[model samples]
Target: MAKDFNENDRLIILNLYRTHGDHYTNFCEEFGYNPKCAREIIRHAIKSNGVELNHGEWSEEEVKKLKKVVRSLMKKLQLQSYDGIPWSRVSQKLHRSDVQCRQKFFSKSTLFKMIPKNQIDGWNEKLDIAKFIALLKKLNFPDYNMIDWDYIKEKFSSNYFNILLRKWREMRIRIPNHQHLSLYEIVDHLYKTRVLKLFGDDPEKMKEIDDFINT
Candidate 1:
């Protein structure tokens, strides 16, 4: 059982995230408390404020291993489109039933190489799992943290620090290496830039972008 934390401990962590620094690795190193414990404290703080956390699923290493195997098979079979092959065919390829693959992805009645591939990726991999999960809870559901994050990357060129810095740039104006700015403004700026190339409707480029933004 998680020990109920007192308000005082919550204040201490709030102060750390506020005053000292917000690095979980640093917080654990300094206080010698489990990092997960720190997260619980933050979650409690948010919950105390009546704000539920946003969350998303991510792939585990085991799932990644399976995905890599599937990707390899797809490449070998030249199966790039959704209609190209059926799961039954892939079952023969991998010796796994559809149920098994769904279990690996934490989903049911869903099929990949169809419309559910990105959802699977979202469940299993989040470019950077740490930020993605935090973002999920922070933003809650029915909000697009992924789009906000993507725009943040396109504008700032870095995930964490640059997000804070690049928020100051005016819309449609290019800054060198994304100077002081914030994420919200980044999305607005992208709309102004007409550079939808980053967010265009292309499948293969989108894949490369997912890899790029997450990698």
Candidate 2:
């Protein structure tokens, strides 16, 4: 007789289904269960979660609406992490499944363009050296040299790290009489001034600050 799965087990099966892209054979092999049992567990999990499988092509209007909703949520929550997004709330507004909404949002370059130019300006206004330090500490890389640029790029879903770093450098360089200060002291001075803002209006000055820091 096949063992009955509990709620937790069903959730795990559902997650596995998503991860494996509906590969029942992989699920069976992993759980030592038959394909029929695996399919039943997944179906039950989907139904119990009230997640509608609306696998239809999204319209242009829906895409625009999704961007608007996400932008609003980002500003409201001061969202820092992509995973922290409330997909359930988004789905409720869009009348789509949470999985569908999430998958759609990440399918192309949609996430990168979700932040408006005005929002970028808003961020620049509120940003300061102290906040930058706090963010660095929060990301567990307080030291500029210790930061994993690739990891940060992937985490924020942004490819503009070079531009961001160049902006930071420009802000740092603006402090007068800083030529005599050591790298560490310059960082401390910026912390004291609390006037540094990341990301300049111009994108042409972007260069890899990683190379500068590493050397």
Candidate 3:
């Protein structure tokens, strides 16, 4: 007959499975347990207890710890994308899953707080009039839904597409009679009159205009 396992025994079996991986059956044999019985107990425990997960709102300390661990791992691994983060390892430290850790880190509120103000401001400033005009010309002043946001993000090296969309809407509001003007007409008008004063002798802006014109 199989032994009646308590909570402690269940935990032991689960730990053994975690530590021994696929060879856990061998470890169970060494410990005088029927391998099949041990496996059954582990399956039941995992179903009921969820790999010892602590599911609820994250504590402030946990948030701080997550930030620290992610930064260390990213630097050590020289990771470029968030997908490269070893969330399984992070979960071992934080008692969270890779999915949970990733979701928390990339959640809009958390991401907003994590990004530096200067960096956000820099992204905001990137869609200047020259670039906006250039993009409008290239895209043929397509409607917001018609724009290929992923292509725009890649081409402009911008982090967030929503920001770009917002900036475009705001820019359109600033333009006079924008609804009636074709992109070429708008550029010709801006170049002939408004562009110089709007840029105000900024050499970088002049260079951007020259580059756009040449292209």
Best by lDDT: 3
lDDT of 1 by residue, 35-82 (tens): 678777665444333343222233355455556656666687885332
Regions more than 4 Å wrong, model 2:
1-51, 80-83, 115-215
Best by TM-score: 3
Model 2, span 1-215: residue lDDT tens: 22576656655666777777556457566766667777765553453355535446798889899878877887899975454579877876775777777777765356546545554453332343344433443455445567665665453324233234434565566878766755555566654555233433323311222222223
Residues 1-215, model 3: lDDT tens digits? 23586657666777887887757888886767788888776554343335656546899999889888987898999964344578877876786766678778766556667666675765534425556555555566445446555555565534444344444555554679988876566655554444555674788876775675345
Question: Which runs in model 1 stand beyond 4 Å of their true positions?
Answer: 1-69, 73-89, 102-130, 143-215
Assess the local accuracy of residue 79 in candidate 2 as a C-alpha lDDT between 0 and 100.
74
Give each prediction's root-mean-square deviation over alpha carbons.
18.3, 14.5, 15.3
Report how far off residue 162 is in candidate 3 (Å).
Answer: 12
Superposition error at 166 for model 2 (Å): 23
* Poorest stretch of ten by lDDT in candidate 3: 157-166
Q: TM-score of each candidate?
A: 0.20, 0.36, 0.40
Question: Model 2 Cα displacement at 145 (Å)?
Answer: 22
Rank by TM-score, descending?
3, 2, 1
